[model samples]
Target chain A: MTSKWFLKSTGTAAALSSLVLFLYANLRQPTLTEQMLPVHLKIFELDRTPQAHEQQAVLAVLKQQLGVTAVSFSQEGKTFSVTYCPDKITAEKLRAAASLNEAFKVSEKTFPPSPACPVPPLDEVKHKVLGVLRIF
Target chain B: MRKFVLYFVLALAVGMSLTACNDDKVLYEIDPNSLYSRLGGFDAISAVTDQFLANVAADNVINARFAATVANPARLQLLRNNLVDQICEAAGGPCRYKGLNMRAAHTGMNITEQEFNALVADLVAALNRFNVPEKEKNELLGILGPMKPDIVGR
Candidate 1:
């Protein structure tokens, strides 16, 4: 009976040890979801033709302060559309920064949710011309 | 009975030793640059971007905007180059981006967050078309996902 009791105790200790080890290992490794998600920013309807160098400088400042990456720009006559990552900066902050700078204008806009996949209908040759014209 | 106990103790010791040995090593550590290489380098990036842009052009909500700017093939090429540079650089690859800032380049065009999200959806599709693994895709998107704040405006 004593030996059986010892065996049961040993098994319980082993199980506890295994549980502790499992927790410790998990605690050591961080999950990917724990990291911060990236923000997307878009600036639209700017003068895309003359190529505003000063505006570019302002954008550089915003990128540095906010950790922005992947910017996109489009021009339709004098209007330009630009998009980038906002990192951790808030929209109010971006607005305040742009407001302080005379070279750029913040359009009345709202943050839009990103799509999970690219749109396909626009790629068709028949729709290409019309599609290109519309974004402008 | 004593022999069985001894054998059990020995097995336990061996198991503990093996666990200790593995404790020093990590189970997964993905190399970011190598992940980019597997995605087909610049060519693959360009292809995906091309497909993405094409999709953007078709999206009714933002098709007008994408079409206006990316109409010219030459302009599209420039845009593709800039985008590829940014993606490659973000993915820990060897590439320097020489494109304009997001806000300055986008000022006055009036892009809504919804439109930007649509573009991202198209991008995700492109990545899927290229068969990028989920982990790597998430990693790449993590690099690109932050751009939402800069792209959405509000």
Candidate 2:
């Protein structure tokens, strides 16, 4: 009788473990990767920055491009920020696309390095860190 | 005779009022055309930038000023970005340049007037390489030329 109880309990534990393992294997959250994110932003400088009417024209052209997800003009109306799928197109291609209307100039604007507060270059670090956190 | 004088004075007042209305055209008229459009937009701008950089690399006069930038690819690209932004922003385009202001950025760099002029010549060469018309070239330069004061020295 003692051995029978032990065997029954062990069998029950094994069955429960198998069921949980099967559920976890089937439904666990997918890992996060930088490629999966819509987090990249690039700033493009348009020389001969367009005026109000011309800005609309430029914005319209930019919005029509293939990979550009969003477009915004800075307050001064000389630089534009673009969010795009890095997978869809290269920055150089986007830059060329920006110059379609013979706008005076198009170039990527670089920000000065911040000595006081440094920023990470990409979202890879965050994805890599969060990738290891398995809640199940 | 007094009646004649009154008529003439009234005529003059009306003439003055008509003249005053003509001046408002200068204030309210918005030019839809931009030099940006005239210069072939982003295409020409990027071209000029590449040509300018190449000219800078080849020119002994200003190449030394960019020695550090040339040595580092990332730094060279950043410098290119900054230059393009300056051009794009200065010509009244749609970008607000977020980099350090010329004076502040150059404060300690101690860039000389000669170096500044050489840089302009390099840029002008690049502009000419693409056959940019005189009017557009001059207009772009006119807008950027004033920046010399801020860039020449601390």
Candidate 3:
């Protein structure tokens, strides 16, 4: 009889704790706003040889014309990469600058939308996956 | 009493799980027609193309050849419309391109690979001046670049 009573008391305590948690959760507000980062535009095929001062000058001109705050210049083999904010400057502007200088060739590739952008609407396969996960 | 408590705990767990699932709801989709509207549609493309042709006429490398054909604004405008339509359609937008295949259209023009590349550079500058976004610009170029096979023909 005493064991039964102890079991009952512990079960009752667990029930009360769960009840409080449920009430607190229901009262808690859901998060709505999400933070997004600025998009970057990449300019490819800039000269990367040791005498790349001309390339640097072209990049400076691009930065000034496009109103980009941050510029990253890096080399891989014979090519250089210039990554800047897409909101301010475009990849085409970079290419035009390169064309005028005759020192760089600009090619563009569009990256998948960044995580900062809300996920695109799921297709049927994605919908099925979410359904299997009971996420819908 | 113990049975009642056990059931309540189970119910709470299920409720929390269901609430967690609600966050996965789909919000919205990007409009399929956005690329057309963003590219300034037909008029803007023609305007930009006119400017691009003028720029090409002044470019030393390809200017001589380009100047000969670019004098005809009506022909250039038609070409621009076809180009924009191809770009728009390729980007999942609703525009039907009614232009000839690249090879046939550029045949016998004697457009060297260098001149073809210069035209691309000039078009890029024109699009940039018109504030076309990078993704749209690339989408447009992707359609244009594949034509190099026919346009360069070397």
Candidate with maximal TM-score:
2
> Between which residue pairs do clashes occur in model 3?
none
Model 1 has an lDDT value of 0.52
In candidate 2, residue A37 scores what lDDT? 25
Q: Provide a comma-separated list of chain B TM-scores, one per candidate.
A: 0.72, 0.74, 0.62
Error of 1 at B104 (Å): 1.6
How do the residues B1-154 of candidate 1 rate in per-residue lDDT, one tens digit apiece? Answer: 7855765566566545544533111343435557557786656765566556544543456756645244343344345556766786676555556566665556555678887787788788768866888888898888788776666663
Candidate 3 C-alpha lDDT tens digits along B1-154: 7887777777676666655543311243436466656776545664455446444543555544533233332333344445555655555444556557676666666677787787798778778867888998987788667778877753
TM-score of each: 0.42, 0.43, 0.38
lDDT of 3 by residue, A14-118 (tens): 876666455434633321110111223232443344356665675567557654433333332233334344566676776777544565555542233221111
- Per-prediction DockQ: 0.02, 0.01, 0.02
Better of 1 and 3 by DockQ: 1
**Candidate 1 vs 2: which has more DockQ:** 1
Which residues of candidate 2, in runs, are more than 4 Å off? Answer: A1-136, B1-32
TM-score of 3: 0.38
For candidate 1, give the lDDT of residue B65.
64
The parts of candidate 1 lying over 4 Å away from their true place are A1-136, B1-33
